[model samples]
Target: MQVMKFDMCYICLACFCIYVSGCERSNNRQIAGEVEGERIYLDEVDGMITNSLYEYLFAISETRIIAANELINLKVLKIEAGSRRISVDSLLSMEMRRISMQETKLKYIRDNALQGGVVDERNPFKLHPLDTPAGAEILNNSYQKFLRIRLVDELRVKYRARILLSRPQPPQVDLTNVTSHARGNLKALHSVTIVSDFDCPVCREAYPELSKLFERYSDHVRFEAISLSSSVTPPILFAECAAKQQKFWEVYGYLYGQKGYDFNIDSLIAQFELNREECKSCLESRDQHKIIETDMNRLRQVGIEVTPTVLIDHRVYHGPLTDKAIGRFLDDLFKETPNPGN
Candidate 1:
């Protein structure tokens, strides 16, 4: 797994929300961008444009940084027959700024616990204990109030820098173009939607059952897997690339077909009959990268938090996507209304 230089801002947001609200909530919002870059090539696999993590990072750098320094690397992509250029520092800075804002918000709420009677609107901090008057008396101490105010002020300044730095520059355009090939596939399906990550154990485990389910109901199912790699690589977009080659089902079969399997890039890429050059090129292309970000933004809009999150019959499933569970849910739905689809 490639260790990302930037702190995972999502984790920071989670911590901040938990501290402030005393409730478990997540903050994984998607920011969008428009591309004014050169006309590029994209591989159409399995009726969809292929995307990958490598591509997304590239796109972000292009939009964020005016110039790519020596630290930035440019590599030729085989799939699109294009060069992918990116700045490491710029990407790291973007992620860090995101984390900083979250941390600052958490600190602000903590600081204004109850000093001077001005409390934070989202107070997660506890007031003085009240088992007896002595505990309540301690709350009246001026020293404690002073300490809290000082702490809040200091932390706020630190986090404000982060918020400013990570703030997303305006997106030039929103990338949500579904290729003609992809549209055709959608028309064939009773429903077209994105599934959860490949790295998720549940996703791996659910692979065979999902394949079987899709096969049995091919007349009504159009399934697209969202590649949520625990690693930095964009596994989902790679899967999309395979789909363009009309190999999505085949690749999906090979991937989910194996039980308790661990998939790596080399192993998975080797299995494809795709034009290695084009697949590689598209996987690293700037446009494809932007598309993946758009997809992620769409997923976030629908409030997806975990992998193996499925949208069957327009209903979102966040829990385990098991055979019995799904079957029971589907069966019950059909039972309640014999013609739910209609």
Candidate 2:
């Protein structure tokens, strides 16, 4: 049995938003090169490589978050161990004995087996699994890893330790080609961008939660969906055609509401009151497919390769797509704090 791991990185942006950049913006505005007797500033070159810059900033922030947690835990460990007149290793050993992980894992396995489910011998059941199947001998190493994590969490609470690092600021996405499909407050400071394909199953499953996000933040947050189909899916282009009539969101909802991937063009026309001849012409010409190409090109420039990549406020968000997770993100984004450090 292995103990549960603790996440010292809460990734709480609200707690980490206290960054006060001392660097001058005038540096970026400094003239770099002259083109045809015209002076060129760094902003043009900066714009071209904003993706790499975002990645660099993200790396720095993530490293700071992780290293701060590690240092805080070490300090707390030393303090607690010193109070008890024991070495840090001895303190960890004592704490590890108190965790009921063995009983928990056995119960979990027993419950799954009793329910006639095929429990994977390789995953959570396996203690510190190697490349091969899990065995009992290697379990001690896995237990030790989890023990330290749990101990760190306990010490953090005892010491009221906090990590102080600001979250990275991502560059703004180019929204010119995608404005037609956008819904919500156009002037709102906060925005959500989803790169998705209509036929992708994961995209289909995500719409419900996305719908909730739209509804929940309808007042302040705008949602702009960009198609991710490399080639044309008729339904996807059809939605774009619908955008001309200001029915993109309606078509978007109708497409995702279906239980299966296959869509009927005539049914869509009938339901949405679109002109049959024009809709057919639009579908045949594939003119709207260019929107997808534009989306693809823009996403590539930003280093996104997967379907359903969600960017909130132009920052790539990699978190669970649940209401609670989104709520925490929103809270982090909108709430004020004395110091932004997590």
Candidate 3:
């Protein structure tokens, strides 16, 4: 298993993860390449990259933010150490002693040990070693590094340093025939299309909030769910068939309301008022799965790799949907765009 190895490195740079790859200041009009002697500009290549691989841009933007903040933290730490007339290393060593060994952070480190991988080897100075005892002295080394970051955080606030970088926006995709279950204000100004798995616990937990989003902004937003599941079949194929009868959302709520339980035919029919024989026939049909495949293929083109990917006005937001995040995003968007015909 690949791990963000538990390695201690040449301080500061390693602690802060200041090396951000795939970031550059480019002149848009510069000739990036030539395609059969026709000039291809930087902006053209950039636009293409952003469209097909938006996550690449997102990662660059995130690391750039981290690098920028760490730069601030470093500056603040230097100023504090200088004021105290001590070497920066001495200051760090002194401050790091205040960290407690029995904090909850150790558990987090252990939990996250298996999830790390080579993010970008552009700057290989920072290393995440395996958590194995044979790999490195686990506890002390990780805790010392933790203390360094914790100190960096304290110094950042103390010095009134803040990061002002904005995240890169996701590519906008114009979706058609993605789902038959499009709901809420059909003619609404903003449209939200969520592609997800009903079997996902996170997706289930978020279902009500998204439904409420439809209800709250029923006049301003249109909503839909494109069902896709990897380990299951009935819920995916069955829901799409139900969508033909405008019973998709009913089936959706029913499936999720089961709370990770296997799909039940009797309960589904009773709950959704679904026709028993018709549903059975449709669910059994190989053609019904084609509808699901069509939806998934359409979404995969827009980079729908994970469940519950929300596309608001075409920008992709991955992970479980949340009210605070979605609400704030909607508010900002509404502010940017005035009411229609205004």
For model 3, how many clashes?
A: 6
| Candidates 1 and 2 compared by lDDT, better number | 2
TM-score sort, best first:
2, 3, 1
How many Å off is the CA of 70 in candidate 2?
Answer: 1.3
After TM-score superposition, what is the CA distance of residue 57 in candidate 1 from its true location, in Å? 39
What is the alpha-carbon lDDT of model 2 when measured against the actual structure? 0.67
Best-fitting candidate, measured by TM-score? 2
Model 1: per-residue Cα lDDT over 94-157, one tens digit each: 4345555654533633664633233122453534443446434554343334443444344445
- TM-score quality measure for candidate 2: 0.54
TM-score of each: 0.40, 0.54, 0.52
Candidate topping lDDT: 2
For candidate 3, report its TM-score: 0.52
Candidate 1 weakest ten by summed lDDT:
70-79
* Candidate 3 per-residue lDDT over residues 1-342, each given as its tens digit: 111221222232233222212223523356779979999775655554554444544445455665787789789989999999998999998887655444455464566563352111354555545454523454445556777888888888888886666655665775765754677777767778777786677778788788777767767777766776663377787777677677887777777766666568777767778788888888788776776777777776655667767888768864236776577567656667744742
Question: How does model 1 score by TM-score?
Answer: 0.40
Model 3 residue pairs with clashes: 4-128, 5-128, 5-129, 5-130, 6-128, 6-129
* Model 2, residue pairs in steric clash: 15-340, 15-341, 16-340, 16-341, 17-340, 18-340
Q: Write the per-residue lDDT of candidate 2 for residues 1-342, one digit (tens) a residue.
A: 111112323233223332212112444455669979999765665556655555555555555566787889899999999999999989988877676454354553464343232323356452332333433333434445656787788889999887556666675655565433678877677777888888889998988888888888777777788787667677778887777777788888878877774578888888899888877777776445665667677777666767887888777775666655666566667654311221
